[model samples]
Target: MTLLHMSINAHDPQRVSEFLARILGGEALPFPPFPDCWIAFAGSDDGTAIEVYPLTHQLVAGVDQVECRVGGERAEPTFAHIALATPMPADEVITRAGDEGWPARTCNRGPFQCVEIWIEDRLLIEVLDPKMRADYRAGMTVRNWRAMFGMNTQ
Candidate 1:
């Protein structure tokens, strides 16, 4: 029932892959089966992974919007942003993100707090606090999860 991996469309897969590896402490490995993709495997040794794919690659079919219709409006998913539980402090993550030129902001959604970093100024990544990730893994509805950790300010 645990998440195994998540694939994201990246304008530059190789660069994004390296960026994720540096921030998330993962190995960016190329998939032999997919010539144009790489995977940034982070989290626990047996946890989840972040799959990086070229945005324009044939695989993605040019559909870049990762959105869903809600109340007749387009909106992002609750867990839309990739959440990474890090051993490093939240401040450290922000510092590194800044050094790498990624726009980052500290956010608190209800009981959960994280530093949301926009990779390449487009992709969303939430550097989570290790202390609170357990409660995050406890499984709440997407609405609750969004209300607690999503980026929707409205």
Candidate 2:
């Protein structure tokens, strides 16, 4: 099974986390460096964690800004990021996301023309395509197909 959480570095960790939380309906989280708050959602403890921290990097491609600043080395986030799914319908999720200042756009990537996310140089998320889910289920149960190349169930 795929792991559950992904982390990212944030110039304003609280703001970035809250930005994600609003769309995902996550709980407010306490930020590090004291007296600040971040945001996160609750899920089964699938053994994963996300850590957001501050850095300094000038806006390139002009999508980011210094909403707040913590002076130090201008460390650009060159590591992991996260993708969050909405329980709400995709259209509603898109609309609500725009309303909450997450500029979202959709594209297709991966097998069978899957729907994917390009959330502003953040995480690349594939919105669960119903067809893909069904296909996955079918593939798992089809033993003749599954056993072809040493995938035989014990």
* Worst lDDT 10-window in candidate 2: 58-67
TM-score of each: 0.41, 0.31
Q: Which candidate is the best by lDDT?
A: 1
> Which pairs clash in the backbone of model 2?
none
Q: Clashes in each model (backbone N, CA, C under 3 Å)?
A: 0, 0
Compose the digit string of candidate 1's lDDT tens values, residues 1-154: 2343466756687888778877777556564335567667663434355667654433211133222222322223222346677778788889999999987777653445667777776666767766646545443223333454443543
> What overall lDDT goes with each candidate model?
0.57, 0.42
lDDT of 2 by residue, 39-133 (tens): 35433222123445545422222233212344557644233444343344555655655665655544332222222343554434434334543
Q: Using TM-score as the measure, which candidate wins?
A: 1
Q: Itemize residue pairs with steric clashes in candidate 1.
A: none
What is candidate 1's local distance difference test score? 0.57
